[model samples]
Target chain A: MTKRSYMAVPFVLGALLLILTGYWGYTQNESRKNLQTNLGNRYQMAFLDLSTHVEKLQVLLAKGLVSSSPEQDLVIFSDIRNEATSAQGDLGQLPLANPALTRTNQYLSQVGDFAYTLNKQRARGKAPTDEDWDKLAQLQEQAGALNQELKKMEVTVADGAFNWGEFRREANEELAVKGRKRGQINLVKLERNMEQFPVLIYDGPFSDHLERVKPRGIKGKVVSREKARNIALQFVDKGEEKWQAVYRGKVNGKIPAHRIEVKPTGAAGVFADISIQGGKIIWFLNPRTVDKENLTMEQARQKAANFLTSRGYGKMAPTYSVKQQNIAYFSFAYLQDNVLVYPDLIKVRVALDNGQILGIEAMGYLMSHAPRKIPEAKVSREQARTMIHPRLDVQAARMVIIPTETLKEIFCYEFKVMLNGQQFLIYINALTGQQEKILEVIDTPNGTLTM
Target chain B: MKKRIGIIITGLALGLLISFGVWQNQEVTAISQSLYWGSKGPNVVQLQQKLKDWGFYRGKADGVYGADTFAAVKKFQQRKGIKADGVAGPGTLKALGLWTAETRTTARKPGTSRGVSNRGDITLLARVIQGEAGAEPYIGKVAVGAVILNRTESGKFPDSLNGVIFQPLAFESVSNGLVWRHTPSADSLKAAQDAINGYDPTQGALFFWNPAKPVSRWIWSRTISTRIGKHVFGN
Candidate 1:
């Protein structure tokens, strides 16, 4: 080839490279603009949603101050709760790590919680007390201030003066605060304004200082980790051949417990939770699946009884059985001195295909299995029988303690009777002779249950 | 001693036949967080519908997992002998026959599910009625079928036909192995179909039983509305 032609080729290649680089830069710039715009839209949407919800929240709290009817109070409280939650959620997505934002989140959370507790009270058909009324008035005042400040900020943002790109994920906390310090987005000052807001504590479940019930069954001396492991292994394996249990240390909860992992030979992992003081197995889960159905439910129940009896769980009566696939779950209530103690319950899941115990949950038994003095029935069976309708035929009766509607435990004479070919249980209060509860005996494919 | 030895050998053989290699792989749907009280999402909607289908929930399935939904879930969990915590985690959802997103696409086809949907329900119902009343006259069998159908319609009982039949301890034959052990007869299938088609042979009987079976004295007080074959029907 000629030297002139070779030189021409090099020049053409340089021009081609320059064109390609220009095209690439143009596309990158285009995409960058689109991406930032998309993010800005989301931030703007959340900001608007947050500001408007806070306004609605203040209005609802004001309405709550005037609402006399329980029905109207429920509606106002529900709106307050919804507004508080959505505002909190939107603020979290704002990508602002300013400690000022943390106060906002906390304020919203307390608002939501306060509304929740009031609504729950309304659900039980109760009216709010004077204290709740005062709290609602204070909340309305605080929310009104916050809503005004947010509305001012919203106006500034709508005027195309606010830079949402500054609060992007890439921006640091310092940069976000720089705007707040300059009185641009004065959320920081607004947050500090509400710092003296009451903590909004209530008798709701999440609040601290609530009466936490201690486990009554945890009455023995603290056992060694090794001993706990061995106890767990015993519940895991019934055969004479000793199995192994791996100690997983202590777990702290309402009831303190030692954890153990018992993966028996030729079996799946079985996680066990044993009480630290009594060394009792609170719960154990054998995460194994069985397919074919080999043993009958009766055989499985017998196996469960044998397992319990061998482990010193005395005279347990099977209360309910639930079957899923090839596994049959039996919940046995511990019988104490001929009385069926429903509180002390243990669940045993047997693999019907192999007659192997797949899982055992003894939380009920562990939490409430304390020896109690068997009180004689104040009302005799003959008297309790009179509480029933004349047409009903009596079948079986027992003395038992059952839970009441308001969380009280009542002792009653539980009469299991036949009502129109179906079975029903009538629990008559032993002391008062009033019918405490009547449960229809529902017969399922697996077992009988009183509902 | 020889007979005892023979019995022991027979038991061992039976045990081996029963237990050898019965493990089947279960499809576990991953759930990062449990769906509990105050938890709201699409997943909660999935949970509500499943529990509703199983005769648990009574309210509208409006997808808001509210307090009524929580109570229904707790009742279902109690029936399943589980924690009864009212949380629809992976295990609870699976127990109620809901498939996760991935399983919905990969494990099943659109047409395949609809094919087996009520076919299984009807077949199981037919088998139950056949086993319970096969020995009685054809009218008695239809009456038995009618009772189950009526239960599905009754607001006091479960809504679905399968729910009413499979409700815990609903039928003695179900617990006693007569239902599962027997294949459905043609007459029983026809009776089931007739019952589903709104045939009220027993004049809206909620229950029926053979008087010779030595039931509770309360059975006699039901004011026996009709008697077909050896069975007495009652509302």
Candidate 2:
């Protein structure tokens, strides 16, 4: 090749090398820029999270100040403590490239120490007095200013509008001042007091449930039924009085359950159960009023009979005591075609001497009260036979009017199906063609099972 | 001319490589310093916020690693059941919700923690006593307090603190954490602190009440010794 051509080739190669160098340099620069930019973005997000937590604490403290209840106070204090701990954790995880933030964190720690001491003191029962309050207020004011300054710095970094170099220099200069404020938070008095107060109503369930339910943590322990009953009565009386504030008219049988038992008041002693519920007397088994003052066994049976008559049961009959307990039974009869359905039993246990109503079990009354209206067979006894799984073929299904309550009616197609070598009575909603409830019927070949 | 061109190419290549190496070195050093000192970067700022949420970093979340930030780091370590080292290294940063830059692509969810539970009334009582008098000077005094609680549980001490603490040599502060100038931390509170800090100054000792002023040594003699605080921690 000619010398001129060789020279031209060298020049061309040099130009190519220059282009490659420029691209590599540009890529490297861009990568570095991207890293810095990502770092900055992460910093802003972290700052925002920190400030938001502070705001949350401020809200909690404000609420606590207004409420002044031990329960509320404990909850808010616990939240504040938790938030502070979390904030500290987050800050530790970050790359605080700027030294100023490190100093700011130290200042926050001091303030946190003060707050913690305050909470502990309040928990102990001895809250900070006026002088302590004044000092705390001063500390809070300083913290507020620090928070504002941090916020401003955060905004500057976040927006990328401020001169980063200048901000860094200024932050460095302010570092020393922040450090001086660190140990200045002398909250020992508050801490010592917090260390002393025994706050019984604490952060979770015990406080939350009792407060939300508005149930008095009644201080009592009654072992006997009579005592439990007396407590129930007292609870009803007090509840009645409390209900006057905004009386939602008393609805019968709408009382909240009264769960009574003795529990620890603190470490010292257990409080007796005298808690009220729904402005009603519940769970204090007042058998005397139910058994003695109320109707006698014969009288109650008569009353129950009259009650059935008032409701329209035409052929229902009452049978007097035949058992050794002198219990009375009330029965009703219904007929479909020529078959007579055996009536449900209303067993009443009465005191033999005075004939007081000891207990009245009226279950069959619901079944007997409904009219006998069995619908025409929807899927003939043969069609329903198809829906039953082959493994559990239907043995027999009958149309029957099952009385639920005296006032309610259930025209059911009761199907007897054998499942896994066992028999089950499956009741279908004759109207909807849906299975409602099932019962496992245990009947020995010797007939041990009864309804 | 060819030799001159070759020399120039070699010189340029060497200079470029050296410059690239210097830049790389500087970038690495800057990152390491930024990370070590918890520089006011995005991750640091977020870390600050997370710490605040978890009740650790109480300082402004400005992303700067000043004294307050370091103290907050220490506090976080204390809370996280880690060594209370102030430096925010990889472990501490990960804990604080910051990932090592190298760990960026790994995709981690931040700031979830598990805690310990102290169960039962008797165990709870032991925990509270441990928290309060764990730092007491006399082991016997701490043990005496536990003994009083034990005695209360037994048929011996009056069924209440007023009865047991008021009894002769039962407690140095018949009026402590409640009546005295300082109230001890609650049983649950102490348990929480212990679960986090592992500050088991009480050892396995159950009994503890102060004995700085006086205590019936006979009560102390009935129990085995375990050191906690200035008092004796005993069962």
Candidate 3:
């Protein structure tokens, strides 16, 4: 080939490379713009939905206050509950950081839960008390204020003066920078306004009373760090291999505990949390991989039972066992006089390969276990059986103490029934003969699970 | 000129034959591909819908084959007196009336069961744990999963697992698409199962963030519960 032709070939290749680069850049820009538009639309939709829901919540609360009829009040309260929940969900979908909207989120949750409780009361043929009306008035006022704040933001959004995409970018950039300026958007201002709502004390899960509940099961004197270490070692180390206990740190939460790391010689370490109050092992995990399944699930259950007995867990009845990855997780509830105390529940994980105790979680047990005066059943078991649907064929029945959503324990007659080849567990309140809860029992190849 | 034309025709015929052979080979392999846990496609959607119609599956037939689909497939297999492996192989597909004329049977090793009854929940949680704290210690992974669970229980966050995980900006891994990009390790799955079983090392922490990484300054306002591995947990 001629030298001139070779030089022309280089130019041609250079031109092709430029064209390819331009095409790639164009596609990248188009895709980025598409993604930004999609995200902006989502944020805008969520914000608008939140504003509408809040407005509806205020209206519903007002309607609830005016409605004296139980039937009308029930519908109004349900609407308020739904609107509040949707508003909370929409608020969660916004781009603001979680801590920025903590108060606002909490307010929405309490409002929704309070409405739910009122709905339940109205369903029970009870009229709203004067106190309930006062709480409703207070909540309605707060909802009005929240709706007003959202309206102001909505105006800016409607005027195209605020762009969630740009706000998200700027907020993320500000978060990355140290000593960043705060409150570029009015969300922080709105969150501050949310802080003035009255603290709700109700029978709901989110009630302030529930947050302050102390552990009913932990009753011993506070143990020293040395005693906690000894308790941890004794609970975790079952074999003869010497293990060293290293104090990790003290963790203060629902159950105040000292974190201890236990390691055998030349082996990887495991961590256990020992409760400071009773010096009992709250939970421990051995993270070793179990690659084989030599022991059956029945054998694993036996191993779990033996482990619990050795640890002084008396009369713990195995309720269910779920097997996963060569580890069988067995749930045991304390059995008191043939009445299963489900609130005092313990979970044990046994490796199916060697029947070794892999893990133990006793938080539920620790939170609720106590020697209690058993209550007499006012309603007979036969009476409770009559309350069940005729379609359900009763397979078994027993007395049990089940905890309500608010952690209040109630004695109930637990009946295992079958219908259309499906099994279900129905709990009837022993005193009132009211159907409390029904759980479907799903027996899969892995193990039995209750839904 | 006639001889050259004849040679060209022969070359074209040879190329057509080879292309047809390749196409046939591709069809055979495609037919042998089994739908198992973590598989996703239109075929999986069909399988799930078929299982649902047969009253064996109760989960949403959204196409992605997960633990629920696996369990349902196993149940169907058991009822049909086939091998009770949680995989949609040719025999199982044929039994479900999903097999086509081009489909072929191929033996495959059964996928190991993760053994949890709520397989879908654990799988999703495990993905989040794997993406967020895959490099952290075992306890740290479990702590991250526990934080997600605690968020579900907290009134300030969404009440359901899916709602909490998929909430906008709640998890950085979800926001950045990292959670879906990687398969969960066995250890991560175990950690998720442990968290679901109520083995919380964080003692009910609602949030966790890696101190070494750039995080929102707002998270600093939360009361720190514990530091596990590189992540600082708070409620």
Candidate 4:
């Protein structure tokens, strides 16, 4: 080739490179802008929806307070519950920090749960009591205040006082340590206003009263770190392996516990959490890989029962066994006076590879295990059987103490029945002869699950 | 110019033939390999999808042959009155209607095994753990998974695993696309399964954040539940 042609080729290649770079940069910018616009639109939509829901909630709460008839109250309460749930969902979708909206979120949850409780009461042919009316009045006032705050926010959002895209960027930046922005500050203010929400005590799951429940089974003096380590080391079945236990730290939560890490010679570590109050092993996990199935499911269950007995869990009866891979998960409940205490339960995972105890979780047992007063059934077993549908084929009958949604224990006659080739466990309240709960028992090839 | 074009066409055809030959060889090798626990590929994906369609598998149809797929294959084999071995060997494949001529060339081998009870929840939780605490200590990874579980149990958050994880802004990893972009490591998966089995090293933490990073000042208001690795957990 000629020297001039070679030089022209270099210039052409350079121009092409420049054009490619420019095009790539232009596309990247366009896509980034598109993404920002989409994100901003999502935030705007969620905020608008939240405002609308809150407005509806305010009107519904006002209607609930004025309605005297049980039928009208039920409808209004249902609407209030729905609007509150929608508002909560919308708030969750926003970019605001969770802590700043903790109180506000709690308020929304309690409002919806309280409304649901009221609806159930009205459905049962009971009108709202005076205290219920007072609580509804307080909730209505709070909803009005929240609606006002949202109205102000709606104005600021419409005026574009702060860009959501920028707010999101600022929210997620790890190094942007400075004063709060307009949008976040507004949310913080709203949360501060919610700090005065009246404490709600009711029969719902989200009631304030449930938060103060103490563990019924934690009944000993606090244990030291060394003692906790010893308890953990003794609890884990190392079996001829010299395992060293290390105190991890003290964990504080619903059950304050001492965390211990046990490492065997040249093996993966095992972690055990021992409750500090009683030095009881809350949970322990041996994360070793089980690569072969050498034991049957029955053998695994036997091993689990032996492990529990050795660990001082008395008279634990296996409720279900689910086999997956090389492990079998066995759920056992404490049996008291021939009545299964379902609330006091423990889960044992036995590796089918070598019949080894792979893990154990006793949080449920620790939370509710106590010597209970076994109430004599006022309704006989035959009476409870008659309460079940005539089509169901009664397979077995037993007494059990099941936990209600509010965590209250109820004595019931658990009837295992079959109909249309499907098995179900129907619980009839032993005291009142009323049907309490029914669970469908799904029997798969691997194991059984109750739903 | 016509002669040169003819030569180029011949060369292109020859290249195509060689590439096709290589592709054909790879396909044969892939088909001949038996799928068992820990095996991963398009074949495993197909196996899992087929099992899911037949109501034997309840796990996601990811390609990796984990415990879920192993148990599913075993269940299918039992139903088909096969040997009831978990490995998808030539015999098992033939029974599954996935057999090919290439699969007949290889002999069956015993396979490894592991298991999880709730396969669907474990997979998603494992991905979240791998994304958020993949580099953290093992306990830290479990703690992250526990936080997700605790959120589900709390009345303030969504009631189910899917609802809690998919709630916008609930998890940073979800928003950043990290959780979905990669598969969880084995340790992360185990940690997730452990958390699902109720091993909460954090006891019941609802929130966790790396203390070194800049977080919202309001986070400090929550009582500190525990600290695992670099992350400070709180209620």
How does candidate 2 fare on TM-score? 0.27
List iRMS for all predictions.
30.4, 27.8, 9.1, 9.5
TM-scores for candidates 1 onward, in order: 0.47, 0.27, 0.82, 0.79
Q: Each predicted complex: what DockQ? A: 0.01, 0.02, 0.23, 0.18
Write one digit per residue (lDDT tens) for candidate 3, span A74-154: 888888889989998898888865566768888889889999998888887878899888988998999999999989778
Q: What is the full ranking by DockQ, best candidate first? A: 3, 4, 2, 1
Identify the leading candidate in terms of TM-score. 3
Best by DockQ: 3
Docking class of 2: incorrect
Clashing residue pairs for model 3: none
Counted clashes in each candidate structure? 7, 109, 0, 0
Over the full model, what C-alpha lDDT does candidate 2 score relative to the true structure? 0.43
Per-residue error (Å), model 4, residue B192? 2.2
Cα-based RMSD of candidate 1: 26.1
The local distance difference test score of each candidate is: 0.68, 0.43, 0.83, 0.81
Kindly list the per-residue Cα lDDT of model 1 for residues A200-285, writing each as its tens digit: 54555323222245666778788889898888877785445446788765555435667777764665456677777888876665
Worst 10 residues of 4 chain A by lDDT: A174-183
Over 4 Å off, model 4: A1-12, A158-162, A174-179, A183-185, B1-118
